[model samples]
Target: MGVSGCGKSTVGEELAKQLGVPFAEGDKLHPASNVKKMAAGTPLNDDDRWPWLDLVGADLRKGYEADGIVISCSALKKIYRERLRESCGGPLAFVYLEGSVDLLTERMGARTGHFMPLSLLQNQLATMEVPTGEPGVVTVNIDASPEEIVANALKGLASL
Candidate 1:
C-alpha cells in the first residue's frame, strides 16, 4: 500500500480479479471520525489509525479463510503493518505502490469525490515508512500504465 492517488484501489481491484479473489476497499472500513478528520484536511495520528488497521486486518483474515482477498490500505508505518499482520494472524502480502511526489500530487489533484484532500498528500508522504526490505512486500513503481503496474505486481507476488 502507498499514499493516496498511488492507485492502490485500482491496482488491488485488478489484481484480485486476475487472481479470482475477493476485493475489499479498505477506505470503506474507516471509522466515521477518521473519515471526517481526513475530509477536514487533518492528518491522522497513530491513535486514529490503530482501530482502523484492526478492521482492515479482520477483513483480511476473513477473506483469507475464504481463499484469498485483496485490499487497498494506506499502511504507512512499520508498526502499522505489524499490527495488521498480528490482527490477521495469517500470511499477508503488501503491494507497495511507490511513485514520485510530483506524480502522486498530480494524480491526487486530478481525482475528485475522494475524502482525502490533495493537501494531505504531503503529510502522507512524510508519514510513510516505505516498505523497502520488508518481508512479504512487493514494491511496484507507479510511473507505468495501470496494466503494466498490475502485471509487475502479479509477477512480484508470484515470486513471493
Candidate 2:
C-alpha cells in the first residue's frame, strides 16, 4: 500500500503467485462513481473510500477462508487500514510498496487505462500515513526490479 503508481498490483500478483495463493486487485472493487471521480482526476474523500475498503476487506476475508490471498489496495490512511482490519476480523499483512515521488510520477505518467490520474498523485501522497511501526505492515523499497521487490516482500512477510 503506497501511492497510486507504487506497483501494488504488479507486486501483489507476483507475491500471490510466489505464495501459491489467490490474488485480488482492490481497484476492481471500487464503485463506479468512485472510479468515475478518479478517472476525472478528482481526489476521493473519506466517504468515497470507506465502502470500497469494506468490499476489499470482504474479498480478502472470503479468500482467506480457503487460503492465503494477496490484494493490491492503496490503504493510504491509518483509519482506512483499520477499517479493513476490522472488516476482516483482524489485521492482514500489508506490503507497503515504497518509492520516491519522482519515480511514482514517472510511473503514473507512463501508465494507461487506469482510473487514477497523475494529477492526483500529490493528493494520494499527502493522504498516505506511511504505516511506520504499524503492526503487520512490511515496507519494501520499490526502487528495484519487480522480482527483487517481490523477494523482499516475501522475506519481510516471513519475518512477521
Candidate 3:
C-alpha cells in the first residue's frame, strides 16, 4: 500500500507476476463518481472511499479463495488498512511503498491518463500512516525501478 503516484500499480503488477498470483489493480474498482471527483482534482474523503475499498476487498477475498493475490491500493491510513483487512476476512500482509513528496509530484506530473491529480498528493501523504513496526508489513523505498522494488518486496515478503 502507498500514496498515489508512488508506483503502486506498476510495482504491484511486477510483484504479482513474479509471485504467480492474481494481480488486481485497486483503481479499477472505484465508482464512477469517485473517478469523476478525482479527475476534477478533488481528494476523496473516507466517505468517498469506503465503498470503493469494500469492492476491492471483495476481489481480494474472492481471489484468496483460489490462490494468493496481489493488489495495488492506496491503503493510506491505519483505518484504511483495517478496512481492507476486514474486507479480506482477516489479516493481510502488505508491502508499503514510500517516497518523498517531491518524487511523487514529479511522477504524477509525468503520468498521463490517470484520474488522480498531483494536487491531492499532499493530502494523501498527510493521511498516510507509516508501517512502523507493524506486523505482516514490509516497507519499501520508492526510488528504485519497478523491477527492483518488486524484487526487494519479494525478498522481504519471503522473510515474513
Candidate 4:
C-alpha cells in the first residue's frame, strides 16, 4: 500500500497475479461522498476516512484462510497500518511504493478516468508516514520497473 500515484493499484494487481491471490482495490470501496470530494479536488480528513479504512481492514481479514490476498490501499499513517493488523490479527506484508513528488505528479497527471486528482497527491504525501519501523512491512522504492519491485517484494516475503 502507498499514496496516490505511487502505483499501488498497478503493483498490487501484478503482485496478486504472481502470488495467485485475489486483489481488492480499496479505492473502490470509498463512499460516493468521499469520491465526490476527491473528484472536486478536496483532500479528505481523517474523520472522513475512518469508516472506509475499517471496511478495507475487514476485507483483509476475510481472506485469512487463503494462501494470501493482495490489495491496493492508501495506508498513510501508523494508525492506519495498525488498524489493518488489528483486523487481520497476524503479521501481513506490505510493499510500499515510494517515489518523488515530481514523479508522482507526472504519473498522476498521465492517468485518466480516475477520481483522484494530482492536486490531492501532495496532501497524501504530506499525510504519509513511511513504515520504516513498522512490523510486517517491506518498503519497495517504486522508481524501478514493476517487475523489479515485485521481485524484491517476493524475496522479502520469503525472509519473513
Q: Who is ahead in lDDT, 3 or 4?
A: 3
Query: Model 2, stretches more than 4 Å misplaced?
Result: none
Residue-level lDDT tens digits of model 4 in 77-127: 889888888887566787878888888888899999999988898889889
Please give, for residues 30-73, the per-residue lDDT of candidate 2 as tens digits: 99999999999899999999889989989888877766788899
Give the TM-score of each candidate: 0.98, 0.97, 0.95, 0.95
Off by over 4 Å in 3: none
Q: Pick the candidate with the highest TM-score.
A: 1
lDDT digits (tens) for residues 21-125 of candidate 1: 989999999999999999999999999998899999999889888899999999999999998888776899999999999999999999999999999999999
* lDDT (0 to 1) per candidate: 0.95, 0.91, 0.88, 0.86
The weakest ten consecutive residues by lDDT in model 4 span 62-71
Residue 157 shift from truth in candidate 2, angstroms:
0.2
> How well does candidate 1 match the true structure, expressed as C-alpha RMSD?
0.6
| Candidate 2 pairs with clashing backbones | none
Model 3, residue 85: distance off in Å is 1.3
**Candidate 2 vs candidate 3: which has greater TM-score?**
2
lDDT tens digits, residue span 17-122, model 3: 8988889999999999999998898889999999999998898888777777899999887888877787886557899998988888999999998888888888
Q: Is candidate 2 or candidate 4 better by lDDT?
A: 2
**Prediction-by-prediction clash tally:** 0, 0, 0, 0
- State how far residue 43 of model 2 sits from its true place (Å): 0.5
Better of 1 and 3 by TM-score: 1
